[model samples]
Target: MRYVKLPKENIYEFLGRLKEYGTLYAPVKISEKFYDFREVDDVKKVEFHYNRTIMPPKKFFFLPREKLFEFSISKAEYKETIENVEPFVLFGLHACDIFGLKILDTVYLDEFPDKYYKVRREKGIIIGISCMPDEYCFCNLRETDFADDGFDLFLHELPDGWLVRVGTPIGHRIVDKNIKLFEEVTTQDVCNFRDLEKKRAEAFKYHEDWGNLRYLLELEMEHPIWNEQSELCLACGNCNTTCPTCRCYEVQDIPSLDGDTGYRERRWDSCQLRSHGLVAGNHNFRPTKKDRFMNRYLCKNSYNEKLGMSFCVGCGRCTYFCPAGISFVENLRRIMGIEDKSCPSEISEEIPKRGFAYASDVRGEDI
Candidate 1:
């Protein structure tokens, strides 16, 4: 990989020049302290300094709702529905989101290979920027703060200018086109970059014995912490929606008025709901709120180890956006008996009055 300097004077120049590549999309501030990834028509409105977007850049590829195909209601005829899309230039993605996309690539591209996701993936050029993390960030635990791979270009901001890493041919092309804007790298520049990495790491508020967290979670199933967390949880689906790694989707058929044609559509779904695992005869596997709640952590802590990758990258969006104020790290520590967790002030507003009954008192009994 080669390093090049993106001069501050050329920042806007770079955005204007990037329009030649494809339809440019970047983070745009929507309201007070909120950002969304939207199409860029004017460079003046693009947001550079932001903590995290409300939604990940994955929405461009795996859309929230997608129509799979149309089928005749009477006859056994079907036709696929896919748009003839143009190329997309997705810019200003942070390192945590980049690593989240990497984890998703392992599922959608590497394992089962979803064609629709692959189509959009190939059509986009990703450009990543270094993050200025907030108190809600714990990416340091799993090295999700920066990526060594998975982006065409990775930009690191410094006191003077932006340090850009050349990863793919697309990145090289950008540097080639704007050769005057990027300076030749020196040994001192590399040393300064290393210092930036250390500074970022030291900024995190939480630390973990990464290799031992899974084992710590494995040896317990009856922690009262899970029960208390469940009572506080709203089961509102915010965590699943905000999380970039939770890729569960639901499929359904919508019929036409004439009953001649119908289309099957798939939309983003959450595994946290009680109805998610429900089947015919009114039977549900994970009937209790605690069962559904703890399943999320177990999947992150237990199942991800089998895949040889960390699912809980600790971007901390789930806790930040949660109405119930459930912090993953705090609760995990409580489960492992790390920090003493008394009843949080956020939990006293409204307790979950009713919960589905289970045969056992232990957490995750139905899982």
Candidate 2:
């Protein structure tokens, strides 16, 4: 990995150069405090210091509603609609959001890969940006506050410039193409970077040990918190919709008026919905609110051991969008019996910074 400097003055020029690769999409401030990823007409509109977007970049890959194929009623013929997938550049992604994308990759890019998702992943270029943890964020405890991989390029904010880390060949080529706009990282730059990293780590509101959360969750399957939360939950499905790692979707066949010709389409689904687990004979696997709610939480925490990571990146979207004021971290803390512990003013121990490590920090390397 190589670290370079992108002076603040050249941000527009750098963004302009990125347009050569694909259509640019970045965070744009829509309301007073809300931001969402939209097509970037002007690079100046990009929100460099956003907390979190309303929707995750997962929508780009696993579309909310997409037509799988068009079939003829007379003949058994189908045509895939993924041939027109175009390249796109998703910029200003936070560390947790990037990690969420990696989780999706493990599911869709592994065995039984979906061609639609595969095409989107192939055409998408991920450009991550460093962000400070908000009051709702708990990515620090989840170990996803800083992403070391799964992005083409990641930028760390600096006083007068941006510390750009190249993670892939495409990312390196981007820097090389606009080499004149960048400068070599200096000793002072490294110092400033470390200071920023420390500050960001200290900004997190939750710093408890999340290493054993999955185990605790497994043991507390019948805890009362699930019943309590289920009562408050409106079955709104906002949590699943906004979650970056939630990948539940339902497929349907839309028939024409003649019922002969039609197309198959899939749309996003939520576990909180009553019809999610409905099967033949009017039977629903997750019939009650508590069952559905607990399933969603368990799926995020204990499932997917093969991927070696929890489904939740601790992005806080689920909690943020919840209308009933249900907090995922708080619920987890309740399960772990650590609801009384407060965030310490000082970090208990040194926080290991992610991304490109300094030369001196690299073991077995001549400094």
The top-ranked prediction according to lDDT is: 2
Model 2 lDDT-worst window of ten? 354-363
lDDT of 1 by residue, 1-367 (tens): 9889887778888988888888999999999978989999998788888888888887888889999999996789999988676888999988888888887887789767988888888988999998766788888877677788889999888767788999999899988988988897777777878888788778788766555666656555665667888999999989988887888899999999987899999999887888888889999998999889988988776545434667877778788889999998787766554564333324423444121121122232332
Query: Candidate 2, residues 1-367: lDDT per residue as tens digits?
Result: 8999999999998998898999999999999979999999899999999899999999999999999899997897988777687789999999999999989988898889989899989899999999988899999877888899999999999999899999999999988988999999999999999999999999999877777777767766655677788999999899999999989999999999988889999999999999999999999999999999999888998656665678899999988888899998888877665762222313222434321112222222332
Candidate 1 versus truth, CA RMSD in Å, comes to 6.9
TM-scores, in order shown? Answer: 0.89, 0.91
Off by over 4 Å in 1: 303-307, 341-367
**Residues forming the 10-long window of minimal summed lDDT in candidate 1:** 353-362
Clashes per model (N, Cα, C within 3 A): 0, 0
lDDT of each: 0.80, 0.86
In Å, residue 114's CA in model 2 sits off its true spot by 1.1
* Per-residue error (Å), model 2, residue 224: 1.7
Off by over 4 Å in 2: 340-367
- How far is 339's C-alpha from truth in model 2 (Å)? 1.4
